[model samples]
Target: MKTLTKEMQAAITPDMALDLLKQGNARFVNNLKINRNLLQQANETSDGQHPFAVILSCIDSRTSAELIFDQGLGDIFSVRVAGNIINEDILGSMEFGCKVAGSKIIVVLGHTKCGAIKGACDHVEMGNLTALLTKIRPAVDEELTITENRNSSNPEFVEKVSEINVKRTVRSIVERSPILRDMIKAGEIQIVGGIHDITTGVVQFHEVESL
Candidate 1:
């Protein structure tokens, strides 16, 4: 109910951070949200923001990190893009969030029925979005289980690609950012990936492994 502080953030271990998000999502699914005054939280965090986690998620309206995680203001850093792909700028933001800003964890969150993943699956092209969706193309191509229907129309294929995208993004973050890679290696921070079920309001973490 109170704004996160540096001490609190520092106290969180990688496993603890994962647990916190799990509990938050449990609260979300059950509609048993914590009672907090957002205006008060905003006022308390005005001086500084000590977000506990940095969430790389989609720009999809249904996958808002704050709402899905049931976090309040100054609770988490939300870095959003169409496909949750990592670019130079996004890697810089992650560096700042964990290396400089004292966040404990980084979560690459993808969701079921994600438009971005579907676009990538079907090779949807637009002006600038063409390049953006291209980032997710590897995931679509990596889904070998669903060989027959490898397009967005196949719900299973779409979901598989979405999961692959989350894991790929997680790997890309550590590969692209030396600072973040060092932090993960030194046990100062942790990176994980998850898939959000839009219909169920649940997030399932993919796997736990060191980068």
Candidate 2:
């Protein structure tokens, strides 16, 4: 497949962008990946990149956005952080990706069995990571179920909190960036969240409205 052009990016509606990702993931799951010459793709994208989507995902080894989405070089802008939490710098990157760089979608991707989510669930306080994990604390606090087993060791509670974290990150992006919000309001761009099942290689997008 060819790298997306500016017109192609601009032509994608919110629904279409979501559909593209869904289809890409389906291809990934079925191992029907598109054949591409990676070296040629690298050369094609050398002069510039026109990524179609901006993915805010975790630092997890198992959840690389491009690999899971079946995208090649210059296909997506990946903004990774522990817990996939949003902050000022991440918001700036998203702004640049959508408003300046012509990305059509922003996906806040969290995954099951994420170490960052586990850290947040367990309330692990390290030196700098303490502050980073603090961003996900609200999601942990918002989780009402599994009161007795609130730690990361509880798989059910951890998954629930992970989902909440993805939704919260989606909201935070819109709330923190007026540029992104206007883009969404004008239907120029879209933001959504999803959870990746590491063991199964499945990514389940949350309801669009919930984003």
Candidate 3:
């Protein structure tokens, strides 16, 4: 596959953009790859980028959205942060990726065994990161199934909080950004959430909430 051009990106529907990521993840899980010259794609996208989807994921080294989605240069916009939490900066980036640049879909991609989620689960505090972890505390609170072992020591609690955080970020995006919310209502774009299994390399996508 070649790098996406302005027209190509424009032609892709929100569903098609999502399907592309799903197919790419399938390839990733099977250790498959598309034969594309990275250098050539670099030159192709030098003038401008027309990415079809914008993915907000964690800053985990193991969870690079480009690699996991098997997308080449200019295929997608990646906005990464700890916990994949929603904030003003992230919201602005998504707005630019879609309303300004014409991306078709937005994905809040979280992963298993996320350190930030763990910190939130444990209520870790140590400077600026304390504030960041606070953003994830709501998700940790929403994970009600784990009563006894609510801290990071329990893997199940951490993972549950991870999943909840992704879904929350997905909704928060729509709730926070009026530009994106209007775009969603006008059928111009869409938002969804998913969890990336680190060991398996398979991303289990969640439902796109109608909110």
Candidate 4:
């Protein structure tokens, strides 16, 4: 596969961009990686980059978006943070990725057994991490189904909070950034959420929710 050019990126619809990720993840799960020359891609994208998607995922070592999505150089813009939490800076980055950089889709990717979600579940605090984990507390609050073990020790609760955090981050991206929101309304971009199964290496994308 060749690197995406300006016209190629422009030709891709929001839905098509999402399909590309789905196909990539399928390849990753099955170990059917497409052959591509990384050096050639590096040179091809040297002057400019026309990535089709912007993925915001956790900073976990196991959940590298590019590797899990099986994308080559310049295929996507990756924005990672613990818990995949949304903040002013993340919002601005998404706006730049879509409105300025012409990316077709924005993905908030959470993962099962995420450390950040686990920390939020237990209310663990330590310096700056405390503030960062606080951003995910709302997701824990939103999860009302788990009444018994509402802590990270329970695998079920951790996964539930992780999904909720991804959805919340997706909502925040659309609602917080007018540039991205306007672009979504104009049919230029789509924002979606997903969860990566650490054990299985499968990314389950949620239904697209643009604007």
Tens digits of per-residue lDDT, candidate 1, 103-191, equal 98999999989999999998999999999999999998898988797887899999889988888888888777889999999999888
Candidate 1: Cα lDDT at 156 = 92
Distance from true position, residue 53, model 4, in Å?
0.2
- Angstrom error of the Cα, residue 146, model 2: value is 1.7
Please report the TM-score between candidate 3 and the true structure. Answer: 0.98
**Using lDDT as the measure, what is the rank order of every candidate, best first?**
3, 4, 1, 2
Estimate, for each residue in 82-153, the C-alpha lDDT of model 4 and write its tens digit.
Answer: 999988988888888888888999999999999999999999989999999999999999999989989989
70 in model 4: Cα distance from truth in Å? 0.8
Candidate 2, pairs of clashing residues:
none
In model 3, which runs have C-alpha deviations exceeding 4 angstroms? none
- Tell me the alpha-carbon RMSD of every candidate: 0.9, 1.4, 0.8, 0.8
Candidate 2 residue-wise lDDT at 43: 89
What TM-scores do the predictions have? 0.97, 0.96, 0.98, 0.98
For candidate 3, list the clashing residue pairs, or say none.
Answer: none
C-alpha lDDT of residue 155 in model 1: 95
lDDT for every model? Answer: 0.90, 0.89, 0.93, 0.92
lDDT string, candidate 2, 169-197, tens digits: 99888888889999888888878899989
lDDT by residue for model 3 (29-114), tens:
89898989999999999999999999999999999999999999999899999999989988999999999899999999999999
